[model samples]
Target: MQSSLPPPSRGRGRATRERSTVPRSVSAHQEAVRSLLQAPLSAAGPAAELPLARARGLVLARDVTAPVSLPPFANSQMDGFAVRSADLAAGRPLPVAEPVPAGADPGPLRPGWAAPVMTGAKMPAGADAVVPVERADPPRFPDASAAAEVLLPQTAPGTYVREPGSDIAAGARALPAGTVLGPAQLGLLAALGLTTAPVRDAPAPRVLLVATGDEVVAPGTALPEGKIFDANGTILHAALAEAGVEVVDGGLVPDDPGVLRQLIREYAPSVDLVLTTGGVSMGAYEVVRQAMADQPVDFLSVAMQPGGPQGIGTVDGTAFLGFPGNPVSALVSFEMFLRPALSELRGLPQPRPVVRARLAERTDSPPNKHQVRRGVYAEGTVRLVGGPGSHLVSALAASNALVHIPEGRGAVEAGEDVTAWLL
Candidate 1:
């Protein structure tokens, strides 16, 4: 006969009480972080005056009104002569009084004669139509005495003349506030005689990235047994830069609680957001969790492989996040959470591209977990290039997309339909 062992102690609950805190479930923690990160921003000050050349990708802060009508005045659209329809009714040669070569004032036009005008040339006063040089029968010459006078064979009123204000009216709202400035917008501003554009001031957020691990070595250093090189810092730095973030790489902080605490105390107050990798699990030496023990942090174990662990909180109003240590896990976590949060703060749309593709091979995913498998999408089919191991770098390189397999799903047979989010 065997004796029954005493009931196990509820150490987890006791530990929570001892620390006066509890680890929030994955969903609850994710929701809390999402809410804080996507909070509405307060209204900013008036628009900034930026040079038109430097205003690309910025939102206009105020409405721009045209100062004057487009074309400024009635102009000739063809290179020919400007004359009244009555002058051509006689079907006789008309003398050219003056020349209007685009930007040159031809002075007032006499009622019974024609003025030689070039395309874009301002029509002389009292002129009502423009006869193209090609349409005139024997085009006229500069000197009336030495010229073969042309007959206006076609006499149509208001023909070949661009009326003033036809394209845009004076004092009209050219572009409303919040208009995203692009090449077309810049061209419109230039056409409206505006040398400067009113654009929203870019909000630059300073970010601090801290990559933590004991087994992680710098990229240039030699790797020992069970040790790997760090890539998250470089990858995340580039990603943040592309997203318009100003990042200062805080470098690696090993899984040492005292050092981690010191770094956080020093850098947390200086940055708008603090990002880290590794040390948020229930391991005995989880430095990130240990360091923030005195501070506010919500630990979460999400229902996702390779990126299941996360921590989010604030240290004196500065936002902080801890992601898993695996390279793919870190990137995937960022794509799902941080990127969207930052885009929301910057008033820009999220960058996830979704499309449907047929699976090229059989695949299976665990129940109640969203499996984001990397694969290559081609010819309307997605080929799984690598195993679902997060540490597989070659697999990551071979894939260009993440196939989102929903929870509680089983094997996906070949040629089965699935949705993929392009990276």
Candidate 2:
């Protein structure tokens, strides 16, 4: 959703529009968005001690030290006979003392006696090695009362033994603060015998997502003449949900200012943020500007391509942000200005992996505006996806990275390095 006041259209698009003043830099507007999110994020409250099941996808609030060593005691790594290296003299037959099942502790191994231990069973005292059940002569464990003698091959010390603290030592920092707990990370905690973890408690904030404009209609419906299916709503809803937001979809709002205002009024009080796409530019039918004329919304032009028209401030006492109506523009606006801010507030879904890659082909960009071109970054190079048109929604879908062409760089040659945010 591109506003009427868009950046200079590069690569097969229209010429640049004249502006009243130099637009704000992308970094400057990013700082502004950060400031905007602080209020809602702070209201989310403090740290929480959560069970492992509920801690996944949440950032760790504090470092977790191992309370107990992994493999706390010496345990058998295989089903074997617990034997002392000194006991295996010339492969002599030794009487089987007893069988140790998984949990029961076999007291110390008697001298010249063999104890059959199951896998994961704790080893007995005075036993420095183990001979597997297959290798021991007779190859089977007899009853504890039956007198069955076994012969064990000569083996090295600590054979088939799981030494204490081999995986991780006690009191060691297993996971540090700010680590996002996933299944693997939680498994590590479980291995350390922890039932719970301390994580940064971030509430799922409610967001009112508004998709405006008369030309836009919901998907699955036949588009009338001069109308298209709404992409902004779907795009924004998925992005919000990915960041762990409780999205209240406002549906398709026509170009009527009254209708949009009523929708905002109905949902704004219940939500932490009011996010809208479409109708923010200075065009004649800019319904967002029309609706928020009396409200405290600062509609301004940002120095960024695909999405340039920006609006930030409050509407009816609710924090708000308005993006352009073009589908690609809306997505770019989110990735650039909104996503990072939300991630900072509630660390979920993780941040975009950023990398520097060489350009796969020569490309042109606007003189002073920041540009985000959808690209396919493979190996060590990135190739542009589509021309620099905000309306190229299909092209955006095919991209795996957003190649960032910073302000002041005009024409870039092949092999030149550029920053790309992996999608």
Using TM-score as the measure, the top candidate is 2
Give residue 129's error in model 1 in angstroms.
Answer: 15
TM-score of each: 0.68, 0.81
* Candidate 1: tens digits of C-alpha lDDT, residues 54-97: 88877788899999899789999999989998888878888767
For model 1, state the Cα shift of residue 46 in Å: 4.5
Candidate 2 Cα outliers beyond 4 Å, as residue runs: 1-20, 78-101, 109-118, 126-161, 200-202, 347-350, 378-381
Q: Model-by-model lDDT, in order?
A: 0.75, 0.85
Q: Give a tens-digit lDDT track for model 2, residues 44-161.
A: 4588999999998788988999999988999999998998888897678988877888999779999888899999999999988888899978887777787899988998999989
At residue 9, what lDDT does model 1 achieve?
27
Clashing pairs for model 2 are 1-324, 1-325, 1-326, 1-327, 2-325, 2-326
| Model 2's TM-score against the true structure | 0.81
| Candidate 2 colliding pairs, count | 6
